[model samples]
Target: MTGSIVFDPLIPWPAIAALAVLALAGVVLALWRGLSGWALRGLAALVLLGALAGPAYQVEDRTPLTDIVVMLEDESASQALSDRPDQMTEAAEALAVEIGARANTELRRVTVPDGAGDAGTELMTALTAALAEEPRARIAGIIALSDGQVHDIERAPDLPAPMHLLLTGREDDWDRRLIVRNAPAFAIIGEPVTLTLRIEDSGAVPATGATAPLEISVDGGEAQSFDVPIGQDIDLPLTLPHGGRNVIQFTVPEAEGELTDRNNTALIQMNGVRDRLRVLLVSGEPHPGGRTWRNLLKSDSSVDLVHFTILRPPEKQDGVPVGELSLIAFPTRELFLEKIDDFDLIIFDRYKRRGILPAIYLDNVANYVDKGGAVLIAAGPDFASADSIYRSPLARILPAEPSARVIEDKYRPSVTDLGERHPVTSDLGDGETWGSWLRQIDVTAGAGSVLMSGVEDRPLLILDRVEEGRVALLASDHAWLWNRGYEGGGPQLELLRRLAHWMMKEPELEEEALWAEATGQTMRIIRRSLSEEIGPVTVMRPDGVTLEIELEEVSPGRFEALYDGPEIGLYRLAEGEHEAVIGLGPAAPREFEQTIATGEVLDPVLATMRGGVVRLEDGLPDLRDVREGRPAAGRGWIGLTPRDAYETRDVTQSPLLPAWLVLLLASVLIVGGWLREGRR
Candidate 1:
């Protein structure tokens, strides 16, 4: 119970102040004039004002509630290393028991976990949230059981009571972490990209050698080791071996006496893009389909096109001089022989053997395709003739052989059964109606799956692989009808784009591939194949745990599965012969970035509240009651501020004097003052 004086005046406070000032002035003037009644007059004025300014006794009936002690337990990944988890558990349980047994005290245990993605441990975030639940005035102190490697210290809230951080690691704790300070997200294939990295050592530095053994590997292959200097930035130059997502893993051999080897390894995922795609377009003569190919290739700013049209054959004998017929001859030697390997893709549009390119040049083109190059053939009615290029050496790699027959009937193209499961032709089945073609060469499908067929189920489009390169054959030259938007048109642009990218070996357009991409903690697994159904995918986690998950057919050629990542590390995905590796969070997760514990982060905050910083490894400290603004810590014990806060169940206030008593006092004082002044 507590009591205080409270005011409930009959008049406003401003008016009362003014009236008191006037009464004081009049008494001072009377005293200075040698008036004998000044003392009585002053006493009378004070009495009258006191009656008007009502004073009451306010009493509060409070039931003392328990003081709150917040115990923040760090359950983040770093805390689980070595014996820290056990240490924290032991200390927390002991603290809970001790706090619960204390008189008028309560314990609030808040478990702090890893933040979203690479945000690390948010100890202050947990503390703020815990504070919000309990009354600020009632919080006696905040006790946290953590490694003290908090990431968001700036978010610490304004604490009302002492905050004590009980450290959770030993003095001998040490750790090593690999940091990738700078890396490009997209790097051009075949071009060297520089990555900046450093090896950071925390806690007690071991007496190891100056140089550490670092290893580098691409796409989960065998690693190559090198000696790199510790505690210094090193620029690593790397060239992507292929297009699309390239997973590069870098690791350093774990040292003895370190906390854990989790930070010694890091995963880097970067995209391999093309600086410029070189395409060679050879046209037998000016035709509408040739224009369509030109337009499609030119649409992409990344493509560098080198087109050549054979306007006149060498065999044609015109009665004109060579200089009059042409100003510059086509550089066949420069393009087809010397720099053939420089091109990524080569297209022959309705081209036949016109003696424009020698037989040796044709052989070189076939060899080019054999040595990891792309080629496409668009045959016309002339392909079935005697002078067809199919009779040349290039026929060895072409997928289809044209018979001596030409189908001149109007036919609409349709995707084959196998095409439905191939990425290049998979999306062609968006249910859009394609225009009709008037001319198509009758061909016999030899090697490769027929993706599309024209009239009477004959092969229209066939794709195959020759050596290390890719080949595609289209049996019609009137595909430009779709580009002209005839009969509502079809996905001519889209189909052509897919075919071109597939020939270039784009990973997304591959018919068979296994890949995984992660967002937050969930990984989207994609499996593409030409088979009707894909088998189960074998997933290898960073902890060497293998999981077999069955994939569901999301579309014709695509199978998808969403798996929540168990932790942040490199995840390996394998489906039969296809394999892929993806990094989940950062190379070294934020939780593992700093594993050693210290009190340098929150020491200032603890000092501001006059709190203690103790280590659980030394044993849970004894809790003691201390006054606010005093040192709440000793050598083997910590202290808490006993707020003695409670809820006021009842409140009563009464005027010190009753209304009649106040009136009687005021009348006597005024009468006494008037009679004394009249005598003076």
Candidate 2:
């Protein structure tokens, strides 16, 4: 309760003051003339003036409210490292007991978790939210139990009293991190692409050499290690081995006494693209179907086609001079032996064994296929004759053997059961309604899968793998009839494109493959195979936990499953002999980017609030009372200010003097003065 004096004047204050002045002057004149009633007159005038000035006593009844102290507990991912979590838990319990013991104080504990996505630690965001919930006038102070690695420090709220930080880590904590400063999303295959990287050490790092051993791997292959200088930018030039998504991982061995190995490794995924595709098209003679093959390869701007046509063989006797023959000599030796490996795919369009290319050159072509080269055979009726190329050394790599017979009946190509599962022909429109072909060479598939058949179910197309290379045989010369819109043109363009890419070993066209696509933390695992039945996929998480996930066949031979990963890191997937590695989120989470604890991030705000930092490793500080605007942290103790906030419950006011009593006192004094003057 509190009390104070207040006034409510019965008349204007100026009028009362004027009457008092005139009465005081009359009394002074009477006293100067030796009047006996001068004192009594002064007493009467004072009494009348006091009645005009209304005076009252006012009192208030108030209830003391508790002061709010906001305590933010940092529970982010980084805080889980080492012994920081234990330290935080202990400090929180101690602070809670101390705040409860203090008079008129309450604790608002806010547990801050890891931020959404890659936002990292959001201590300030949580603090600001907690502060907004309580009254600013009753706030005593703010405290945070953290590693000082806050991500949203700019959002720190305005402090009503003081703010103190209880740091969680030891002074000797340190960490090493691998940083990929610059990397390209797409790099041209077989060309050197430069990537920028740096290795750094933070916190109280020990004395060590200036270089560290770094290991690098592509597509999860065997890693190669090299000594690299620390704290300097490194430009690494790499040439991708295949055209597709290439996963490159860089890791450094964990050093002794380091905080974590999470930031010591980085994963980079880049797409490998081809600058241009080199193709060699060899035609035996000028024919209608030959132009179709030429046009198909020429349509793509990325394909460089080198076409050669044997207009006249060595056996053809011509009576024309070499200069006037309008024929350039074919560079058979340069193309077949010198630069054969330079071509991505070699097409034989109705090409038969001729004296133009010797038997040794054909033998070299077979060797090229054994060493990761690709070949396509588009046969004509000549493939069944004595001059067929199947009779030469090239027959060793061919997928099918010619039977010296040609079917002249018109037949529409049909996809076999195997073809329906093959990537090249699986999604090509319904094969039953395609245009018919005029003729096909009879052949027996020896060591390959027959994808398509025609004319009494004989093999029409066969694909095979020979050593490290791939080969395809389409035993028909009249496919050009379909391209000419006969019987409503078929999917000639799409079929040929898929066939070519498959022969060149495109990753997406592989017979067996395992990969994953990620949208946020959810991953879609895909498995592609030609077999009718497949085993369950075995998934290995980032923390070495393994689980088997059964896949559902969404389409013919394509299996898939969706998994929502609990953590962000590299994931390893395998089904049978096929395996793949993919990253669900960032290679290095933001929490691990700065593992060592320090108060620099929140120092500026703490200083403005007249607070200081206390390391928990030095022992949890004892809580104490401090004056507002004074330092709230010291060597062995932290402090919270006393708010002394209160709420008014009731108010009362009473007049100090009654009006009747004042009038009676004035009349008595006036009469006494009059009687004294009459006696004088």
Candidate 3:
């Protein structure tokens, strides 16, 4: 309850000012004429003005609002290190108790957890949200208990009152971080690429260890170790061993007295791309399909196509000398014996032996495939003849054996039951209205997967792995009809491209493989196999926890499971003999980027509000109220502003003097002044 003098004016302020001037002029005239009535007249005028002013004693029924103090507790990943969580909890509870016990004060406790992906500690973001939910006038102070490793400082709200930071973690806390300053997303195969990195030590460094052991691993292989100097940048020159994604993990052994070793490891994902894809395309006899292969390889800017057409065979006997015949003799010796390994893929299209390539040269091709090389055989009718290339030494790697029969029936190609799961032909368009093929070399399917079949269910396409290498066989030569838009064409381009890439050992089309991809906290686990159904996948989390999840069939031979990752680190997935390693978030998450706790970032913010930055290590500071812009903190103490906000429920107003009393005073003064003037 409060009482004060207030006015409900009976006359307008402008009117009152005019009346006062006339009264003052009258009194001054009377005084100048030496009349005693001047004093009496002035007193009467004062009473009249007072009555018109409507003065009244007002009493208000007020309810004081409780001042709200927000105590935001940081529970992010960084705060969970060592004993920081315990320290934060203690400080937060103390803050709550202090604020609650204070007269007419309330505590709004807010717990902040880790943010999504690399968002790190969103302390300010959480504070802003809490402030929005409460009244600004009721906010007396904001107190945050954290490790002071905040990531979203720019989002700090405009403090309506004093703000203080009670820092967590001990003064002796230390950490070692592995930093990757620069890493490319793609690198040329066999060419050395430069990667920039460094090692950093924060807080208290180990006295005995000046350097740390660093391990570098690529594609889950054996790791190579080297001692890396602390606080120094390193430029490492390395060559990629294979094509496709190469996941390189760099880790520094944790030193003694470190806060956490999470930041001591970094994962870099880079793609290994060939400078150029060298391909050797040999065509024995010219046909319409020959142009298809030429146009396909030539269209790709990355592929180097070396095409050769044998215009004349040894038994042709055209009565022409070898020198007069054609474009220089086929460099068989240079191609087969000298530099055979230079090419990435070797395609023999409609090739017939006909004594063109000797037995020794064919043996070299087989050996090449045995040494991690790729070969593709596009067989024509000649494949079923006595002069077929199947009669050569290279036949050992062929996925299909010739049956000496050539079928001349019209049949549209269709994907086999097993092809429904194979990546190459699984999603290929239905062949209901596809074009028909005229000729197909009949053969017995060998130890390989049949991706495409023709009339009577004969193998049309076969893919197999030949000891350290890959091989593919296509039985029909009339697939170019699909390219010519016969019966509305088909997915010939896609089919051929996948077949070529699969033979080249593309990782995506591997028959038996496990891999995972991450988007934020969720990971998509993909398992590719030839089996009908796969068992549950066993996932080994970065925190050494194992989880088993069942997979559902998404496509032919492709099984997938969606799992949510709880932490930011590398996850290992295994099913049978297949295993995969995937990093869910950044190589070094933002939470662990600066593990050592300090008050440097928030000190300026606290100073703006005249609040102190106190470390909870010594002790939880005492809470008190201080004037705005004054020192808000002192030794062992913090401060909150006293808002003294209130709500008024009632108001009353009444004239100080009645209208009749003012009239009587004015009448008596008028009578006395008239008498005095009359006497003068």
Off by over 4 Å in 2: 1-64, 312-320, 403-412, 430-439, 478-488, 518-522, 541-545, 564-571, 624-631, 644-680
> For model 1, how does the per-residue alpha-carbon lDDT over 1-680 read when each residue is reduced to its tens digit?
88999888889989889989999998999889887777777777777677678888999998889898888999988899989989998888888888989998888889899887678899998899888888898999889888898999999999989888899889888888789988899999999999998988888887887789899999888999999999999999999998999999999888998999988888888999999999999999899999999999999999999999888777778788876865478899999999999999999999989888989999999999999999999899778999898999998999888888999998888898888888877767554467787888999998998998889999999999999999999999988898888887788888889999999998888888889878977899999888877789999988899999999988887899999988777888888889888888767777887788988988978888888788887877888889988989999889999998888988899888777876777677667777877886
- Model 2 agreement with the true structure over 569-605: per-residue lDDT tens digits: 6788999999998878787789999999999999999
Give the higher-TM-score candidate: 2 or 3: 3
User: Model 3 off-target regions past 4 Å?
Assistant: 9-26, 33-54, 314-326, 657-672
lDDT of each: 0.88, 0.90, 0.86
Whole-model lDDT, model 2: 0.90
Error of 3 at 286 (Å): 2.4
| Deviation in Å, model 1, residue 268 alpha carbon | 0.8
Q: What does candidate 3's lDDT look like per residue over 228-285, in tens digits? A: 7788999999788877777888988777778888998898888898888888999988
CA displacement after TM-score superposition, residue 522 of candidate 2 (Å): 4.4
Question: Among all windows of ten consecutive residues in candidate 2, which has the lowest summed lDDT?
Answer: 318-327
Q: How does model 2 score by TM-score?
A: 0.82
Output the number of the lDDT-best candidate. 2
From the highest lDDT down, the ranking of the candidates is: 2, 1, 3
Instruction: Give the TM-score of each candidate.
Output: 0.93, 0.82, 0.93
